[model samples]
Target chain A: MRRDFLLSFAGHVLVVGIAALVGMSRAVRDTRRPIVFSVSVVSGGGTPLPQAGAQGTTLVESKPKSQAKAQSTAQSKTPAKGGGGSGSGTFKRQGLGVGVEGAEALGYSYYLNAMLTRVSDNWLNPYAGQAKVLTATVVFDIERDGTVKDVKVEKKSGDAAYDASCERALLVTDKLPPLPPEFPGPRLKLHLEFEQKP
Target chain B: MVPTTGASPGFLGPFIHAGPFALVDVIALVLMSVASWAIVLRKFRTLGRASRQTRQFLSTWGLRTRLGDYEQVAQRLRHSPLSSLLLAGVKEFNALRAEFGNSQAGPELLQHMIPNITEAMERAASREVAKIEGSLAFLSITTMVAPFMGLLGTVQGVLVTFMTLRGTQIPTLQTIAPGISDALITAVMGLVVAIPAALFYNYFVGKAHELEGDMERFESELTGIMRREIVSSQVEQRKGQ
Candidate 1:
């Protein structure tokens, strides 16, 4: 009987140890940022942002009026080039304008804010019962037209249901207000949080 | 009984945080508890009945003289271990008497009766033993498997705990303790279910063996009685001739 107890205890411990190790490795890998390039461009009439890369880019295309004023104020304090169209009103001219744009990009913040608002309003509230907090750093392209294209969830919510909800909400809302013309368009990191009420 | 104070909320509150695996383990433990209780109650009643009937049958057998009277007594004690043995012996005696067909007392007739009586007694012993041993195998299996089931639950709980810790800077005991606790509960439950089952199995087996030994002894005694009767009848027949 003593021998049986010992053997059983040993077996239990062994299973727990192996399971813990497997779980630990998976959790670690899941939490880390993958080292590969993951950004892609949304095709067709949707937000036409360039693919994300080493270069920082502003991706928000259509901003609400309040956001434009905030950008103008922040820009006035700094000596950097202002972000707006170069007066020539065409898609090609806007694209050319984006090529020369520097760091003062208000479009990225506006796009993120809009996405966050939508997430808070539509997805987060309805699914409070099933909500889980997830943090992701996404890379997307901002076409010269300030459209956010190809947003991805870099760090997924451990739960697929919650992650899918976040993804769907982002996809439904298209163009964000345009960034200031001087904003660079290489790759930008946006830290987003989705939280649910307890 | 005096009512005891209620348990503090936190006594088992920590286990709740052990996650889904812990919940599963708790459910399994509850099921095992119910099953163990059921087996204990059932075995208690069955063994009690068997013991009471055996004693009653033995007392009746001691007072009974005629074969017909013994047969009637056996019928009254219908599920008793003694009933089966008595029925087997009586059936064999009747079969032998019919086969002999009014012939004078002979060695062949007596030999046939003894072997038939022995064989019947053996068959009845085996059947009684099986009846008494019912549910003992289930108890043995529950004892053997409970620990492993508990371990499986514990492993699942530990896995969940470690997974929660992987990305963080350092895993602390506070973070890991609940998982370990959850896992251990399964092992505890396994032992709890197994111990009683094993004890009951052994107890029932011992009882069954004891009853079997009694039946074998009684068969020998009955065979001697029958032999004496046959010899006395033969002597009376010789005098009449």
Candidate 2:
């Protein structure tokens, strides 16, 4: 009886230890990876977009000729056209551009862009060399104030760690540029694509 | 007894997929099931013997008018709870009557003996009931707590599952189903342990009540007999005077 008791006790201990180990390993694996949220900004003047994909940089030049043309368009479009011209043309019509401009004014695009930069810098893509290209689409809402809100991954990079890192980075940077006056916002949709170099 | 066999290959592969929580739940449930069966078998045997012995002793005691015959019957069925109660009442009555010496002294003499005998019988009955209820408390606790314990394990399993899901692109059944299955096993185990324990607890309680009622009825009958014997002795003493 004593021997039987000892054997059963040992068996139970072994079972419990193994179970604990399995559970711990699963938990550890889940927590170790990060999510990346990428934001891409495109301007209306037909400049070539950045090559770095979700994490690239673009410079916007405010040239005199472009500003003059934008002012003339605003003046021509206005019905009540005297003192309200400057405020309406520059702040409302010019500020509201399509794509990233609409996204930025709602405060979503800027926040998302900042987030993507941080996530990419943190880790190198392990599959960069082996895989030809990795692409992910991010969906987000732009509020009227030009802030990005409710950013989510519409598609994934397939790697569990990479996917999570993308999401986490998006969540951290939730700010974007003000919407141009042309678009009214409760929510607006913008699609961002991220590509890794082969 | 059914011989233990190796787990079937088809089921074993799936069972291996179940995590540690699921495995523990399965083992605990199996052990509890076996224990419940053992307890049920043992209880049936004990209660059956007690009922048979009590019936036999009562029949034999009723046939003989002499107290000595009843005493002998009580000795033969000492293991029986009913017999134990009867023996206790009879011994108390005999002791009290001997102390008073000659029932011709008065009705007061028999009155004290009746209460003392009743008290002794009741005490003995309670002790016997408690003994019959042995290990039943543990069974009751097992029934109540096993499910909750399983629930704790399941909750932990679910949390791990969700956390893992958050890191993945698309949450699929392959990754999430095992944790859900693991959690459910605990609840099943709890119900398994509790159901039989509750049924047996009620059964044992009913048996105990029946035995107690028998003891009470037997005590009343013994008191009536003592009253008649005392009255007859007193009437004979008056005639002699």
Candidate 3:
């Protein structure tokens, strides 16, 4: 009887130890935050941006003011990016300018905001002299070590210089901070829209 | 596709940093697991001991040329249910014999004692069966409770996740994955604890029944042996006359 008790106790201990070990081992290196960038580019023309990397992305083309008006009326029929089942979702740009408003947001903004700060600080406005206001969407896949990969330009600003500068800014930033150990995956796919300030 | 180095979240990390409610689930899971393990171990030892005692007693007595004296056999095989039945039947037979050999006629005395001996043996066998079945309900309860504990963790995980969404935009999958994943760990743990308990409960129940069956069969055989002994003694006495 005593022996069985000891054996049972030992078995329970072993199971718990294994669970803890497995949990600890899978921890990610970078701090993890939910992706919450509310970037809505109101550029004219339906042209899809020049995607830099491999295919298979659903990009929302630059819609004219009328379509933007139409989309807002239809917005209620669709799922909100923030409220949807999927972890990754997109929302139409609300209001004017690059200000953050009209959103219930998590502390994750700290992480994404910090990343944006790093990218924007390194950027020299590509459209400074350009007469036409252009926007380019860039997708960057970041390694756990903070190294960036496949910095593809999803939408081209129609100006090579504008597109090149956005791509260069990401590359120059070099490495991002490592993800939190508890983050889901090893690689973080970052999508950013660079709009030329008119 | 080949997974790059950091693709898989370290499997161990989420559990360590899980929320309080998920942690509650973990506590329940641990308790159930410990309980199930203890029951399995104790049941194994008990059923195993009974089986060994029964085998030892049967092998020693079943092959004998003549039935061994019940007192000596019962003393040696103290734990066996068969031994207890044997003692009960023989004791009853002796009590009846002392009262009835008011006839000195052995046949009448034997007939009178057989029915009472069988009844006494049956009662002793039932008691033995109950002893063999002791604590088995615990195993069944453990099996039933384990899965519910896991589900409790899962519900807690979802609740916590949704609660976080109250003041925030719907978070990305990577952000919420850890909590949900940790919550699921409890469920997995519950199953881990329950499956063995369920299997062992059935196994031990079967063993108890088999032991009971052996005692029941042995009771009838004992009655037959006692009748033969009485008839043989009477025939010898008549020949001498």
Candidate 4:
């Protein structure tokens, strides 16, 4: 009986050891390769809009530098007629967006752009050369209070790291400035294609 | 799409939520549970039938004074170990009686018969125990493996959860909760299957021992009665002289 007890105890210890070993190996395997979330913004003015989530006012990444320069020059031309901050920044309507004119729309766009940048700042995608470019389309609701809610990935980047970064970007911006009164609607459902560039 | 290793497979979540390893754990648990349940159910019915038949045989043995009555009832009491033990003893007695050619067995004849009867009784007792014990080893084994199986799953789950964080910038609860929960499910299931098996094993052990004791006591009684009959016959022969 004593021998049996000792043997059983040994077996249990062995099991625990194996489990620990497996867990350690898995952890090592997983964390060894990191994904870096590289973010770029495209503003609607024919410039790449701000990353769906980023922080700050001057987060404009156009396909080309000239487009960004033109948008800046246009901002200088538009009077600071919009509410909040220096509303002097011009609203360049993105082709896909519903066109609305004037300084009020431009003010709303700038603030939204800034919020996406903050989200983008928190994102860290996996490293390059690991795989081809992957894109994750994410959708989220912006409440009237500017708190982000129900952020979901509508399209997955076939990589866990990439998809996770997309979700995290939206989540980090738990709160943003409430939509400007010039913008219609109590809540806004926003969609963006977050890409992991090769 | 990159599978979320951290999502809850939950009770009814789609298989896509769990990694292949976690899915295997769930399958193992389900299969083990089914096997354990089957063992418990079959054991209960076998024991119940054996107990009922044993009681009926005991009552019949008490009502009938003649060995012939036991033979007649033995067929109906086939499930009873006590009935089998009695039949073995009686068959030995009759064989001894026939060998003695109608003369009452002297003490010497009785002495030889006792050994033969003892052997037969022992053999029958073992057979009865074997029948009662069918599939019991499976229960014991299931008890031992249940916890380990659960541990395997839990360990795998924790491993998967940690893996989610590998090469990632930040670890969110969303990425961790699923693995943790999946691990917990296996551990819980293991305990659920194991506890009942252990309880039933102990109960079955007790019943088997009780039946074994009854068979042994009856074997001894058979010897004493045969001895008494022989002694009385010898006295009668001396009185006639």
Error of 1 at B136 (Å): 0.7
Q: Is candidate 1 or candidate 3 better by TM-score?
A: 3
Fnat, model by model in order, equals 0.00, 0.00, 0.47, 0.00
lDDT by residue (A1-198, candidate 2, tens digit) is 244345545554676578666664543221111112223321112222221222222112112324523443443222212111121111112323322223233333344334334333332333443434565655665554645677678888676665555555446546545444433223444444444544
Candidate 2 chain B weakest lDDT stretch, 10 residues = B1-10
Each prediction's total of clashing residue pairs, residues at least 3 apart in sequence or on different chains, is 21, 29, 28, 26
lDDT of 3 by residue, A46-158 (tens): 22222111011122222233443445444422222221122122333332211121122222334444455456555555445345677787877766566778888987878
Alpha-carbon lDDT, every model: 0.52, 0.53, 0.63, 0.60
> Arrange candidates by lDDT, highest first: which order?
3, 4, 2, 1
**RMSD for each of the candidates:** 19.1, 18.5, 9.6, 17.4
lDDT score at residue A18, model 1, on the 0-100 scale:
80
Cα displacement (Å) at residue B16, model 3: 5.8
State each model's TM-score restricted to chain B: 0.81, 0.79, 0.83, 0.84
* Candidate 3: stretches off by over 4 Å: A1-3, A18-140, A149-174, A177-186, A191-198, B1-29, B63-65, B69-77, B98-103, B160-179
Docking class of 4: incorrect
Worst 10 contiguous positions by lDDT, candidate 3 chain A:
A50-59
Lowest lDDT 10-mer window, candidate 3 chain B? B1-10
Maximum-TM-score candidate: 3
Q: Considering TM-score, where higher is better, how would the candidates rank from best to worst?
A: 3, 4, 1, 2
User: What lDDT tens digits, residue by residue, belong to model 4 across residues A44-84?
Assistant: 22212233222112322332334444555443222222312
> Candidate 2: which docking quality band?
incorrect
Q: Candidate 4, residues B28-58: lDDT per residue as tens digits?
A: 8666666666666666777888888877767
